[model samples]
Target chain A: MTHVITDACVDEKDASCMEECPVDCIYEGGSRMYIHPGECIDCGLCAEVCPNGAAVALRLLDPAAAAVHGPANDAFFTRVLPGRQAPLGSPGGASRLGPLDVDPS
Target chain B: MTTHHPAPHHPAAHHAAAHHPRAHHPAVVDAEACSAALDRGETLPWTWYADPAITALEQERIFRRSWSYVGRTDQVAQPGQFFTCEVGGVPIVVTRDRSGGLNALVNVCRHRGAQVVREDCGTRKSLQCFYHAWTYGLDGSLRGVPRGDREADFDTSQLGLRRASVDTWGPFVFVHLDPEPAPLTEMLGELPELLAAGGIDLERMRFHHRVYYTIEANWKIAVENYLECYHCPVAHPGLADVLDVSPDAYELEVRPTFATHHGVVRDIPREAGYPVQGPVVEGQYHLVWPSLKVNVNPGQPNLSFGPVHPAGPERTTGYLDYFFGDDVDEAWIKAMLAFDDQVGAEDTDLVESVQRGASSGGVERGRLLLGSEHTISAFQRFVLGRLRED
Candidate 1:
């Protein structure tokens, strides 16, 4: 049910969506931003404000894309990032913590 | 909590969408058999769902003649404020003139038939056709022509935009294509009373949000899905929990021009969808004969209604406009919308599945469990009767 940031945001990390997100579930990757699946409230604000049309509802994604991205999004919060000691794992929100400087790739 | 009636409406006109020449196909639906099947508690032939000839007949007989919901008064509250919509595939524009009167006109330009008033909605003194600049007054009269002086045979006065009947119940506005159609009250039947019973203050309602959607199925299929909730327990589990969709608790009352279903809130409510507000005792849903729907959920003082019209023999399009009280809770509104969206998504899948099966010719007819789905029969009968009249 979380909105997923797709390959459209890979190089263009126009993070205007971060400013509009109420919970700041959007996180910065090296070249993109990933929406923390667990932290997202499914409010759809990120999908509305996304400049490059990167943020999309899980339902709107094609089945092939959804199949891959949904679990990958979960891994971003579960699997440890390159720099972080442990996985992001719902750090409450990303607004105050800023970018974690890593993604699940 | 306060009970209120619908707003008083004044003046009238018609609606718009471009018309295409209906290609006639021969007798497809056997009306007599369909009627007998309904009488015997059987369903109509699946051909009715996929036949272009029958769809054409419905477009002419039912949709064109019926008073269709087009927009709300809030959309055209000020002078020169206008919005365009279609009923029966004919483009229409509704505007408020300087005298504070509403004008409903065929949006098709009198010149080359290019549509005027192209935007979804805006404030403008005069509507002009984008192609030819054929200017029209807010009253839908032809006010200016690009080169009428050059065309010797032109009759500007006689060539003003065509009018259609327009009426309103509270904030809801309806338009008819018939030269002089029956009053919308007749079409509405006891629906206004149903709204009052639900305690929706129609006079105080304002437009909040709209979701325009298209279903890849016949318009009738989509409407039939709405007319009955027998499938709710299996198809719409979330909604089944919120509304007491039990056979005995759900009340379906069918009138000549309309049918309404009232569901008493079950005492076992705990979580999910929207909580019942203090004023709400039940969930009220209504269908005005053909395709217009009025749905008031439990948690909020709101009405979301719209018309479903055919995009093609196998396609349907419509919009649900959500209206709420002044300064209602924003969170409540979002919750209500999300709940509706969840049910709507489920319904889209179901109706589309039905359309797929019906289109395959695998089964001639879809038999119904009359006890739970009588409304579908009533609706199908209404459609067949209307088409038979022609």
Candidate 2:
């Protein structure tokens, strides 16, 4: 299982969890942050030190989210994630997937 | 919980009790070298104390590479929350933009390099350059230029405000001077374990008290003073009464890269468990290399870090912050704030006095008693070693 930042990090994307993760698994996802499950060491350091509860470990085989997590993680590492092309919240832009008003700052 | 242990007498008690690597590694500084420095009354590593050359080197080598604590996440809690802060003297603005993600940008504007946000904090959709009216979104993308079409070869996207490397830990926000810094995780090795043991659940905590002080002492002096409990017995009367500081009560431990001194004040009676969730230690002080100090007091946790704005060899500015758990009540917060004020005021006076005396040049150096002031001696050794390192 790798950590995934939920919508809570959307606008208030404080990156403390990014700094806290030892494996450098966290990456900027436009408005929110994403943890590459493939690279994650599952140290739980990100969740433990997040000032805002924006981080959650995605139990990869969770039949529901697995479809998105795999593609997302791959795109994040390859630096070709579609989310990067346009700003989040822009329609033809980055997907507005993360939390909206949850403040991570 | 017992706070007292019989004081032990040993040759290198200060060396052992302090966080001195040299105590464990005598070869680092030869015995003859120690004798020569001591004979000249200049032994205890003056490089860490009196060296402009080292300070400049630190700004480039150490501060630039390290994850510097810029501000707290709570400062920018709303959709457009924004604040200006400095990390290693680099001005930065941390904003929660319309999109809701926090962005750390050099406070300097892309146009004319004027600072965007002038005040401490507020809500703004985009930061407009006060001088030329060039505006940038919270995410640091250039959103509005005064005249987009006029400038030849003008690429607004290319002219976006430079974003600093930013990361958050608990309620604190950290920024690196490096454009591409080492991940915060690797930089903060074993600190999470230490913070967790001390009961700092970053998610539930809130930014409570922020007190800034301009001290006339080297930043290292404040740091060195903070790492030890030797002065608590003499200087901090209120703190001394509450903390568990008796003979053999303090233990300084280091985890390869980080150094921590655990001193529990077990005898003090609790009012209502601590204000936050954590073990009942009076204080857990952790010092991460370069410039970060976490003082996890029983009721509140305070972090202090800043460049030693060396106006000269004698003057400095000290910036301090205190964070508390969310579950704490307002009354408790107000009381804690009062307590913090007193402690901070007292500390400012004490440190400033030390700076004045040191500047007088009357005392060249002083010896450390083996048992009482081990932490100070150890920290001095650590400072000296880091200064010596390329």
Candidate 3:
């Protein structure tokens, strides 16, 4: 299962998880940071380093609750988000992208 | 572009009244007796460092009430430039308004308690909460609320970001969580004059860099380590080589609001990379109560300002803001920074070990060796006084 960034990170985008992620899969969104589902290696480094306990394993969450984050994270990269049509496949870093202005969870 | 020459050396000026070793430890919570003992050069109980309750008390009584360093005015020099910091776990954002006046606002959004300014620092026309885009003006007035027309009784005029007590002293900006705090200048006492006497130009100093350390020790342990240099001769041989670390040579003056440690530099060794030589340059370390520390080393026109903040009961997060004059060469600055890094590493090792011992339950109280460590005792007394104050 892929790692998901939960609601715990809503306004607290400390991005410590981004620093610990060896693959640099974590990306920044407008309101909250997002973790790319495809790029994550399930290393759990982001979860370990998250100060607010926002990063979690998808398998550990209740299926219904975990459902939103997985797609939301994918939507960030696929750019199926409300305002955009173009795909933003791995832009290397989060600082470059305009914030999606949506809740991260 | 002003330069400062070192003042004349003065020892025996600010020594503690007298040392009086007691056979038995007094009551730990007795503030009056503790003050007297500290006046006579004694330390606080070891348990004070490890107790979680004391940490909470300190946060309420000391950190909340005292003026805390937020950032430099230069950090937010232009209108709409802003930065966020936490004082005793309370998040605050300092911004420069259109009128060039500084404003310190509680960083939490009025909408849903979300942090309005998420990024550490940046230039923003308006602070918009990432949560719902509820926006605030540079002066902390509520500017926008998404879908506000739908609400029947929503009054946008009544809801603005709460302001914290904010002020500036020279280049530094400070905030107080207390609704009404003593003027920052009053709290500073004679620090302005003292710093001037030591040749520190508050207006001309420019930000160089910042380095943060997360230590596995209480915040006080790190602060106490800085308050005294008795550990230097043995624990810090590299530092001792550059600065005179002898107990007789080091001078400490404990004032009502702060403490200062003066160390004259030794004859520069041939191998040492210091750019200036002859007529020894002095090193001054000053601590403004609660959590501010300033260090000015010899042979360099630089100032290191740091604050030790408690992240948890046993964890501390500290960062040093290095400021240097334009004349100081980058190579010499880098070398000085490297030297500071080495000294910091040595200090953290010692402080962490002390933390382990203090938390191990093996010791209840530790002795304060009067001649060299009176400054530490003074610091403990300062903390205890604040903790017990009304």
Which structure among the candidates has the greatest lDDT? Answer: 1
Runs in model 1 deviating more than 4 A are: A1-105, B1-24, B150-153
lDDT (10s digit) by residue, model 1, range B1-390: 001111111122111111323224544346787799998778777767777877888888899989999988989999879999987878999999878999889999888999877799998656666666566777877755644554688887887789988999888899998769999999998888888888788887778877777777788888888888788778877787787888888888788898778877767884667766546577788888799888888766877888788977877877888888776788888877777777887787777778877776667787888888788889989988888885
For candidate 3, what is the DockQ? 0.02
Global lDDT of model 1: 0.77
Candidate models: Cα lDDT each:
0.77, 0.58, 0.73
Q: How many backbone clashes does every candidate have?
A: 11, 23, 2
Of 2 and 3, the candidate ranking higher by TM-score: 3
Top candidate on DockQ is 3
Q: DockQ of each model against the real complex? A: 0.01, 0.01, 0.02
The segments of candidate 3 whose C-alpha lies over 4 angstroms from its true place after superposition are A1-105, B1-42, B147-153, B267-273, B276-280
lDDT of 2 by residue, B1-390 (tens): 111111121222111112222122223344356445544434354333344554555455556557877777778878779888776556788898766787888888877878878988887655666666565767877755534544599887787788888888766778886778778888679888777777776666666545545555656666556656677667666666556666577666655555677767655454432243244345676777654666666655433322233333334554556556666667766665555455656666666566555434456556665455555555555555554466
Per-residue accuracy of model 1 over A20-67 as CA lDDT, tens digit each: 565677888777888888776664556655668788878768899999
**Residue B330 lDDT in model 1?**
84
